[model samples]
Target chain A: MAKELTPQEMLRIDLTPPNKDWMDIPTVIKPGIYCYPAKPEKVEIVGMPNPHVWSPLDDDWGLPEDWKETFLEGMRERLNKHRSFKIFMDICVRCGACADKCHFFLGSGDPKNMPVARAELIRSVYRGEFTKAGKILGRLAGGRKITEDVLKEIWYYMFQCTECRRCSLFCPYGIDTAEVTIIGRELINLFGLNINWIQEPVANCYETGNHLGLLPHTFKQNIEFMCMDIEDFVGVTIEPPFNKKGAEILFVTPSGDVFADPGIYTLMGYLLLFEHIGLDYTWSTYASEGGNFGFFTSLDMAQRLNAKIYAEAKRLGVKWILGGECGHMWRVVHQYMNTFNGPPEFLEEPVNPLTGTKFENAKSAKMIHISEFTADLIKHGKLKLNPKRNDHLKVTYHDSCNPSRGMGMFEEPRYIINNVCNNFYEMPENTIREQTFCCGSGAGLNAGENMELRLRGGLPRANAVKYVHERFGVNMLSCVCAIDRAVLPASMEYWVPDVNVCGVSELVGNALIMEGEHDRPTDLRGEEIPGFAKAEGEEEVTEDV
Target chain B: MGRNLHKGLREILVHKKGPIVEKWRELIHKSYPPETAQFLKREKDRFSNPIGSSIEDSIWPLFDQLIGEADPSTTKKLLDNLVRVRAVQDFTPASAVQIIFALKQIVRKEVLPAAQKKGLLREYLEFESEIDRFGLLAFDVFMECRERVWEIKRNDLLKRPYLLAGGMCPSYMMKRGIKHLEKLKKEITQH
Candidate 1:
């Protein structure tokens, strides 16, 4: 039997901070000096020499030696072809500051998963072989001759990074690891090294306009089902508009949230709020996926994935777009998509339909967050909520990285929680707002193959929640990201067994007040919804629209 | 090892009988303006380079060579040309630390010395300070790129290893991953 490797034993080799003036820089010193507390001091791994355990994904990954030539040719073409890519390449410095900031690295004890190191899996080669460093030092300066193995190593590692720009925040060079990952994936894709799971969804998103490949009819069917769930959960028959042309807003959300988990409940919250406030919104099956998996692999894929929303939005002819709660979806939308693609032809300037306020940054203005919109509605007394409905449990909110860090959406979700829930507790100051930790399973690392790492990385976050749970008896954890919903539960099970994770909308659903007795869907059919329907016409408001 | 080789070459260059003073005169003429350059030439000997009586005196001429400025383009051009010379070119103390200290005057004050120890003086030169944190050069560089840095320090949960794990940071994870590959090999052989 193979020996189990403990975290302390693995982390025995510590790079003692070389005494220096540069070490005084808050960003550099904070991590190196304080890396002892916030960052993992040790990583534990068992079942090592699994020579028998071969990754079928790698075998089918279709990466070959010729991939090096193909990738280099592609990189050269990109560098020569586009000014932005060249400038981006020249401007990038592979400082590892962003590496420790990544959720994937935090979750998985795998060092190859660090943003800078993962980037170096490609950038080092770029530095050594492509730059002046290669010409002079050759191999002595850590420059190596690029080979097929180098390309494969780049492919394997770069793909593992979720390209979450959490690292970009700390990167002294402002080198977006996600952007590097995008380039790496693009080079790998040139040689056809895409994983089957991600590629299939990307293809589905291309073909059916949703990652789940839901047909237009099925898409409508899901909306109808959600309306029924809302009637059961929120006591309102919310008919969220479907492909309504010339509508004021087009609501684009990740298909994952629309299909599964806490995101579905959050989806219901958007529908109920839209109905209560009488906002003109539509959902186009064509632009169904706000989350771009293609952004994970290639910029062309990112451009293509993003192009779908505008194409469909134009087809539907909405005035402006509203984004749902998902991490990378908003990251691509706010940071790259609006810049890479041209301004929308069909969407007009988004005036907050309720407040009459105009969002200036068209990227975020045109792309409004659902939480922000809902919070505003509640603030303005548009939607009436029964706070006691959420009395069954105490809840705390986990700020998703994209919405909070990517778009500065810290207040919107908190506002909704404060108004909608009777009892709500906030997490630690450092762990909230822009400094909030990732759910540890974002950036497409939520794959089944990465479960071990996912749980490990989630430890920090789970421990944080455990603090709240233990102190305040907070039973539920609420966050707005779908990936968080998918990954956080696993962490809760492993690290904080008692705490339950839910979407903010789930608590809202529990707390919504029924206007009419028929709002109870479960009583109506015993097939759906939840409770007993009261006498007919007791209230004029109808649950079924 | 590389530094020692460079030092050995400097010693050999200094010991040679060839016009060392003339070389100094040429450097001063190239580095300074016509007025300053001429003054430096007149002060030094025309034939033999004057050996400094002590280490402090010897470094004085090197300092004059470094900071006594002439035309910017011409000075940079001379430095670039000097950097290309075979012995003093790549192996020069100029490449090793001089230009970096000069740059430190502009962007940062004291980064060049520590940067030299890591063999990262060249790489660090490519970066300009953004945030201006004293020791946190990385954050400063990041801020220049318009990036923000956030720290998650553990205040209470010191007992739980999860809260304080290093892999929580992706950079640490990558470093750990590379470091662990060695451990994996060692552990594998141990069994």
Candidate 2:
């Protein structure tokens, strides 16, 4: 600078890391990466503890006077209560098998985003406070006392994880890193440190029985709007029942499908499929939402929100429940719901009334995913099908993380896709099925402000889709999760502009030939089928004659 | 404008392409943490290690484009492919585009001695200026990619207005926050 250095010298960049331990490297809270902190009113509405206004960027988080005690006691209680938590904390052999398995690590290239380092953020504290050796030998044993910076680092990286369990799939010891993140989040919520994107949905689900905070009438009207679209597009009029007693099945879907585009098309598919099959199902605005955003907050909140479904089912006297296409909702239903809210003796085991197929796997939870139900219908040849209507689309399936890893219902959605669409291709093997990448916006991280994080975390999944789009010409990314329908479209638009995202049932709606229906010339979204324009032109010419 | 100068520059660049690209790739890998850099350098698969594979795939073509006529469209396509990935990662605009400038340092170190021996130092300086221009172009591409990210984010918010605080739903307007609901309702209906 003294001699006015040349631009070449000024442009020099040294990217080497400072020679400091990772523990000493303070976490820098950046905007556009982390979600906004939860509003105190939302926390208060849900009866969570320590409601306060705090910022992630602030030096002081305005923790309660007894925050350390509260946090440590919360950790202690969780460790004692959950044997998996205690075992995960106690397990050793820090093998690096799971280091490269995380999409966030792959996309962002942040070592802390690696599942091992992420778990260590909490595991270090667990060792420091709980284990005797860590207490005696401090940093030598890879343990550190909890500090404000440590707490901040924990909150930062824990939310960075989508809890997709992809890392856990690769853990040689089968250590569930998602469970660590879940417990980490639970402790963070003990001090009211949740992000608004998650807390608002949890509060909304608690208050109005849905994450979108949709009122019952507004919810019904939204669906009626879809029904009207079905009438105008598909030439069908079917009045869907709501809150009616003695219905054989009570259908629950994520409110995202009712509110968001492309997801609404999936909802319309459910309606038409049910109408065609003439199944006795009722929609309950009380138990309207199938998604449990509270699962992102804490186990108790998850169970609290999930209680509505079983309560509504018992009240409506429904025999069993049919869940719509969703990601985390299935994780809750399959893994935790029965343990949290079950032994549902009042409700009978879920059996496909149309196909006479008993869902023995869902015997306890008594809730069958829509894909399983629809696949059984196609298997029994119970629905009129025309795969030619979807000729315009070269489809590839993305297995939503929860259903593939948590529920192992891989073949059902694939079976349905093969039956409904003529042209189908699979993405790369490692990126599908049990090892499927996240949509990067799951676990309540799909907020507007955190778009950069979402995009970075979405790279691995989008990279695979880009491969298929380039090699096999895949135009439609069909998935079974409503969050995938809501979020994957944005990722697709950003990474692979040639591909579009939709739900599996939307393809079904496009291909289903309803009885006594008028001549259908368009897909479910009212886009004209590729070969239908000539037929419509012929019709117009005949009419003129 | 002299044909000999262009030929001499091309010869030096092609002769030294291996060391230059290897050093440039090392600098790019250094942008990440030590452990992550090790993993990115070790993994060779494109799908499993997309960021590393992308950097490897783009740098060689980019080097070739730099040595050749430097077609703006082809350069932009290659730059966009690389910068697009970096724009979304944890990178400042300067840090993101700095990788492009690191190539100049590599060329100067690797090609300068050969050019000096051949009395083409002035031509090599011109080539360095070309790298400066490419670096500036990289900055433009980074900004464009970032703007596209913001546009995608804006579209997401407009598409899902319910995610907005105090949105259209009555229940969303908790604790006397109903003033914006009508406006939000209009926005939703318009959408």
Question: Which candidate should be chosen as best, given DockQ against the real structure?
Answer: 2
Pick by TM-score: which candidate is best? 2
In order, the B-chain TM-scores come to 0.20, 0.82
Give the DockQ-based CAPRI class for model 2: acceptable
Candidate 1, A1-545: lDDT as tens digits: 12345977554432112232211211101111111110011100111111121132232333454655666777787767766556555665655566455554444323455675676566556656577966588565545556655665665565456554667777676666666777776776554445544665576777778766667776676667767655654456666678898888898888766665446666666666567667888888788888887776567777777887877777777778888778888888887776667566557777788877666766433677677767766777766687755665688999888887787878778888888787788877756677677776676666543444444456446656867897899888998888887667656765566887777765555555545524443311122422234456666464484
User: Per-residue lDDT of B20-75 in model 1, one digit per residue for the tens?
Assistant: 33343343232322322333344332111111111123233432332233233443
Query: Which stretches of model 2 miss by more than 4 angstroms?
Result: A1-13, A534-545, B1-5, B160-191
What DockQ does candidate 2 have relative to the true complex? 0.38
Chain A TM per prediction: 0.80, 0.96
Alpha carbon deviation, residue A411, candidate 2 (Å): 0.7
Clashing pairs in 2: none
lDDT of 2 by residue, A301-387 (tens): 999999999999999999999999999999999999998999788999999998789999988889999999999999999989999
**Candidate 1 TM-score over all chains jointly:** 0.61
TM-score versus the correct structure, for each prediction: 0.61, 0.94
Residue A187 displacement (Å), model 2: 0.4
